[model samples]
Target: MWNTRFRLIFISSSTYSALGLLPMRPCSSSDPKPGCCPPSPALKTGAWHSHCARSASPAELCRFRSLGPGTSGDTGSAAIESVQGAKNVDIIVLLPKGHCTKIQELQMTTVLRENVHVFGVEGNSDELDEPIKTVFADVAFVKKHNLMSLNSINWSRVLVQIAHHFFAYFRCAPSLDMHPLPPVEVVVPTGAAGNLAAGCIAQKMGLPIHLVVAVNSNDIIHRTVQWGDFSLSKAVKPTLASAMDIQVPYNMERIFWLLSGSDSQVIRALMEQFERTKSVSLPKELHSKLSEAVTSQSVSDEAITQTMGRCWQENQYLLCPHSAVAVSCHYQQVDRQQPSPPRCCLAPASAAKFPEAVRAARLTLDTPAEILALEHKEARCTPMRKGDDWTRMLRDTIEDLSQQWQRRFLNLPA
Candidate 1:
């Protein structure tokens, strides 16, 4: 696994290009440039997990925290395991109660680490982010506590995800010898638009990629791409692909900034409008640019099930609902006899994480023995009820943890 010494810095539009953290040019040749890029932390580390804590002094307590709406359970589970036994680091994850599948919830709540804090919030995943954002907004508090967020809002997460597009391009490209590398189609099943934003960045860096944004019933991203209607629906629809059930794809602003030639002013104005009205018609010119950069489709619950069953029947490979959403787009392309480049469907979760989806597909569940054992483990999670001031609670928790660390460091009573 790759580890970097740098701490998480919230990237802004003006500074992202200047940071030069990623490549600006496309691949020079087809031979799959050996070490063209470093392995992304998401793959080497864990979902939304950062190595910032590793750089802390022995006596200092570094906190790596995240807010997750708990779609598939992978992010919380991975984040928890990444710092399971680290003495100087703690991970605090907030997951929406009853929103995730039982297995997904168990995977996180069953962890018995002293430094791991999992909260079952009585709200949607999107609602959980508000309090975390509020806490992180406090510059002094964050600096004093050595706090870092391993969420999509953090640039590192997006930076790591960029590697996926490059790897997929190299794997699927038919030839490297041509003057320009052969284009490949990347089908992304996304929510919050983090991975989609990464793909857009990859394309900007000269990767010859056609991005197909795949979504389930929550089709705001699809609608925006297809019709330039950047507006939220009445409500987020629950689907088999629960993780992709997002009304607002927040990362679209990043994509807009990149595609608009890093025009931060225009993006800021547009986003301000969106925030104020919960809807905005994209400028004709920007909408045109977005359409050229990516195609989109919204898969239905029925299609997710059919695609899952079809994959199992044809290839003996079970797919999670989220993955099936992307595959469903691919199937549509083939069924219509559309000419397309080599396509790679990004599967962001495992079928084992969602036995309910597997059952919906009429496929035998293939959960591992270790995963099956989670149910019997002692489970624990703090509840954030409807009337609670979640933001204040989060602040209090962080302060409490910091105080506890200080007490232990001084050999004082708990």
Candidate 2:
């Protein structure tokens, strides 16, 4: 049997490039080649359109462009990029708006202006929580929009754009800071978009991190990962884990792309098929590739509820419903006699965000009032719309801002 702990084998950028993975290279006077985009002929269907459909040769990918204030020599930018490329950069948390409650967390960290764009969406946690003005130059254009309306294509494009922009900001270099990079063992709490984004970003950056997509009872992602079939069943059943009550995960397009050996034509065809019939199965070879790096599991709403109370009772820590899903998955592994490496589950919200869910779980555990006081804390965020025509709006915003940023990026003062 394999050791219970996760043993990470780090691969150099040049080796990854040789293996047809990524074109990343260490920052130096030499050009840092970019990963290739498939030829236009290979992207004739599915979400491929506009700039994404065009072929980007290796040279074109290598061009260093600018979007804002940063040069390859910038210490802050170097710290950020090197952190991503380093073997020690382990678990990634796509923070749920206010991952950092205090402003002190921003010390010496490079916060991109585009991050504020993420906060502007109404009911977006970052709107109330993120220390925006302190980080970005402009937060005016970032507005609240319906998140549910984001379709596969829109999500794919947004994630790709964000990942590329973030990674390419500074040429890859060794960090000047003291933060040692940690190897990524598993990325937990698979809530569709975040998990897929983590996977896509890891692939793009050429990091060898296994993805663990933890899900609540809405188990499409779990099922897809386990069965190699991407499909939608009936409508998603609402539960205490409201944030993860999703039947169809749009970011699966990115996962499908990676699973299919980065063959644009194959991914385009699969996505088109899914759009039509609500199901698509990976080819045998592709399925094998996916199994190498990705695994998923489902935790029921009851398990989430129970886990929340158990955390409060046993560990004296309150867990939000979504976080409970991840905890439940971890324990489930133990129950099945399977070993899990050291893992970190992302907590998307404060326990106070879901007072009712917390109260219900804590009451069952008969917890004291003082600990549960987190429930009554004043929260400034509003409710997000369950559904809306948000796709076009987000696309427009990302495209316009990206264009402006690209110009700024290309015309940097050298």
Candidate 3:
């Protein structure tokens, strides 16, 4: 039964991107090096600034912005680094931003270390935890801003837009090599942000992409998409996937807006009802639109553990609880579809981040001895409320980084 149930298939990008969906763009760069500028002096403390990469041809630079710093990590402000040995190509990563586990952080770090230049961006909930914020700040030059309204827009969705365009522009340039895989077609993200990101990417690329949203116990988004009842759960449950324990998915509004034929009145009515009664139901037509573009599935806490354990025992692969949820959902979808199309799952965390979950799954993470050797802060955090000035600070910081990158570009030896 286990063997029959598990259908592991890699979806080819060609089915989605190359065959008249969204064409893959070539990779080219004006700068041979794949790093942003080190740091700018004109940059004021706690301000946002733009950082960009230029094309080898006389094309405009590909740019994005980042915000000010938290208390810890690089300098007194957020910092981005272009690690050496990074790859030069286009990629789509569904980063949970604030919710990533150490394993995902390491993977991202490894990506940059491979010499692939990364332009960072900020997310709202990304301000939730220290580990995510610290790693993102230290690793990549970022662009950050508040959404149209915090209540409606999802941060991960916005970052995906930034990332998609960042690579799209990069590959479109005349001077670079081509991407091996075509543009991605189906993106399986663990939560609302990932789903929202997929939607944004599809909109930009002018392709009809299938968005598969994976959920833990907090199944509001799942139910909304599946049953047409977009109602809020009364309480939030704590699961192994702690970050995904949100009962209210802010980004669902965007999906509703897109699926409802971009009707502002419909969006306003839904939002008002949701705010008042904590529930909203989609009309059949709108539900049809959502059903056609997205698939939603929920995995139980027990199933998450089993998936994690099974992967470790059968494949020697370790997955954090959140990733386990995504994989489990993927398998379920595959079971039904049997030979499903090319799909990408966003595994934004590592097993090490949730050691207890790993142990519960009967697997052990081979954590590096040096990491275990380091002193760790007491596992405590106070809820930090975002300030109004965050956007301004982020903008100034991005500008500073942009200036520094420009200086580096000018000084490079021809």
Candidate 4:
């Protein structure tokens, strides 16, 4: 499932001002042409690639090595580019359901390339390896079709990608005074096991991290973390905070890698925590430090709605569903602590994405402009149950659309 704890930051902006908050890394300024800020060369893995409108059929166009990532970059981080001609490469996405309700499943099935293969992982509902098995079956189906998954299991990517940000965030902090920041604990609300996977990596790197979680009354984050397992609890639905709706821990392999260590090293260090005690499945006695664990404290949906209203009224900031929860936790944590560590709450999506929720919160509409545009009442999605499969829906739409693909590669070469 997801970790309720979050990465702490030291910034002076209000919740509405997340954009203005200092960035973790600045885009290299003044590049001659675009192709410069590339991902690691190793990522290419030596496959075909292009932006040309070659291969008229979706099936014929999926052999390329690189994928057209619909990377909705934060404001100035990376301009959205359209991958005009990149077609169906196999994809394994971990997300909640109902995320792509705005678009049809067939469209996603057909949009990329004929080889455009897609599999959705039910991370939001926290379904465990069942979703992974479903994805594997899809991969098997696609294998006969000449398409294969980039990452059928999410934990591998979690191990690698998560390492960068946790390290990068502390490195970028001008305030941390750079004390090797190991044992530098990070707590995120686990809606999916992704954040916890990241924390496990940071911990392995010798950083003392307290992986905290927050969930509504029926959430499974506590069950997963406490039992070291995943639960398919149908009772839990989306609360006011939509993103923290996951019930399965997708990246469990990574967690085991940390826990199965010879030392209870992780648990030994973290056992001092109150309601959430730590236990290192690792059995060795090598020098270790425990980053404590913090359990969740729920906020009323009324509180969240009101919090959104108050933030806009008091600070002129727009808080989407997920960010609002972070703000709530932040304010509470600040009041509880004598002095809070500089905290940074990562908003994975834009507030504009959820209009009904925003309207429900009674915030005035802002002009819609691409992702920047938030006023498309017609295109707005309504989740079936709260947090049902929203992320999957989102990943499906993001992967299947011709327009979204185009936006990802807008400035890049053919």
Give the per-residue lDDT of model 4 (tens digit) for 1-414. 111222323211111112222232221222111111111222211111122223246555433322321111111011111122334433322323443222222223223433233344333333423433453456543343332222314333354436544653564333455566523223354454555566656666665444555444444545544443234554456665554554443344345446556335444343323114322232222222222333444555776677577656645666665656656665565444433333445443445555666778988767345434222323211233444553354335434443444444474433
What tens digits encode model 3's per-residue C-alpha lDDT throughout 1-414?
111112121111100111011222221222111111111122322122112111223332232222222211111111222112212212212223344344333333333322222223243232332332343454333333210111113253254343432333232233334343233333344444534544554654554334567788878878877889988776766677765766656567766776676799989998889879988888889888887777778889899899887656645667667767777875565445444333444444335557668877877778856445433422212122344343444344444445554555567532
Model 2 whole-model lDDT (C-alpha atoms): 0.43
Quote the lDDT for 112 in model 1: 83
Off by over 4 Å in 2: 1-184, 203-206, 364-414
What does the lDDT read for residue 288 in candidate 3?
84
Stretches of model 1 off by over 4 angstroms after superposition: 1-52, 55-72
Worst 10 residues of 1 by lDDT: 1-10
Q: In model 1, state the lDDT of residue 89.
A: 66
Question: Which candidate gets the maximum TM-score versus the true structure?
Answer: 1
lDDT of 3 at 131: 32
Q: Given candidate 3, what's the lDDT at residue 156?
A: 30
Residue 246 C-alpha lDDT in model 4 = 42
Candidate 2 per-residue lDDT, tens place, 142-239, comes to 33211111122234434543342223222222232424432333435544454455455665566534467788777877777787777776765666
Clashes of each: 2, 11, 38, 81
Q: Order of all candidates by lDDT, from best down to worst?
A: 1, 3, 2, 4
Question: Model 1 TM-score?
Answer: 0.86
Residue 147 error, candidate 3, Å = 12
